[model samples]
Target: GRHQANDPRPSHFEYNGVRFGQDNLNVFAGLCAVDTPEHVEQMMKVLRDNGQVCTRMGAYKPRTNPYAFQGHGKDCLPYVFELAGKYGIKVIAMEITHESHMAEIFEALHQTGDPTGVMLQIGTRNTQNFELLKIVGRQQRFPVLLKRGFGITLDESLNAAEYLASEGNRKVVFGLRGMKTNMGDPHRNMVDFAHVPVVKRLTRMPVCIDPSHSVGTRAAGPDGMLDISHVVAQGVIAGANMVLVDFHPAPATALVDGPQALTLPELPYFLEDVAIAREAY
Candidate 1:
């Protein structure tokens, strides 16, 4: 259904006492390789300083690479949650696997002392599983932040959100990352910021951008942050209500997608000129 500006149709919800998509603009740093309490604390510091939030997983995901890092799974979740609790930071997490482990995932989320309020993240790989999407939306005890499929179109992405909403769940905020294309381009992925305004106009789902996964290149240049920030500025101006980016305490030593993750200390500067771009163009 179409939405009016006064209605604020897609309202944000609180997770673990932290809110997303409110009138107050907020950002979240996706923590993929964050595996320790110390790193979690450091991440919270980054989030606090930048006024952002982070999402780390409970299960160690190596993702098809036989030689990926498999840290402590549920065992590590508790520590990360404990540290996040202390920092007044929000967390968006992937629920381990599908059904067979739903009970365990719920138990893990509940132990965070925030089952009913935490943010549930569904990554691209699991985007089209209608059954799974329905479960996450219908039975979910918390707010959901759904990610766009790297290979999906704008409509397909919105349909994923509609998948949840159609199932009696209205607490959803759709995420728009990037799509992959072979347009004689060398960039690893295409950041389709154009979809931002489109989605917002169609259904009132607050749109969020993920430049980390959208960049066409997996290789970082000397001035990586500046380059990424330039694109990010374009996204916000295009009508993105929020952003979900990946950053690591030490990018050079990260375990997953090292090239795309922002250096912990590089965030503030990236956000510096964004407002100027927003106001000027």
Candidate 2:
């Protein structure tokens, strides 16, 4: 199409040794939030043991409920970076709600001597925060992961991502985190895996799926396959380049999104399942 003739940005981006659109399956799995140093230590240890170096740690959680746990924010940054460094983690996928959060993360990274890198996340809650998006776009130190708005159309989400690219940071990964409608009741949100290919064709950004948030459950259904396992299969088979899911040392006590968080013990089998799915593709 003539539309792509003028676009000069590459069709993909790379981070932590994993290049998207290259058929390399990179899994970003970890706690939904940093609960304590003990938990961070355990999560990093398990990830290192599994040979997984990328993770998702929500230091600034944006909850719908005002009283809900809103993450430890800057307070937990030092220890989280320390633990990530101790265990050889390369990139910690952390979310930033406000522009200042970026500075805080940078400060923490500086304090830690930059032992590990961080992939800045623009969560679903702030998907349309144009100001924040522009701020992230101006930064070149970290790559960006922008999640689809839970209630907006796909076009809106892609346009929002353009806000970042237009600001000079073309290293962006588009994430599909499902919608907030009830049409997908009995599940968290309507499974949006069908759009994996659509997103790939529409933009140069690599597409990633958050099966954890899309399915909103770790339990299995009548098929006896864990919901997350099934959801991930759909995304991987449909041409997703990366995956971002939630995992915890103990889901029963996770401060946020505990019900959908997979336990640490399930890591091995889950990894195997993803490997098989990628092979199936």
Best by TM-score: 2
Assess candidate 1 and give its lDDT. Answer: 0.65
Candidate 2 similarity to native, TM-score = 0.95
Model 1 error, position 90 (Å): 3.0
Q: What ranges in model 2 sit over 4 Å off? A: 1-8
The digit string of per-residue lDDT tens for model 1 on 45-105 reads 7766776555544354537566677546567666666666666656655443364345554
lDDT of all predictions, in order shown?
Answer: 0.65, 0.88
* TM-scores of all candidate predictions against the true structure: 0.83, 0.95
Tell me the lDDT of model 2 at 190: 84
RMSD of 1: 3.4
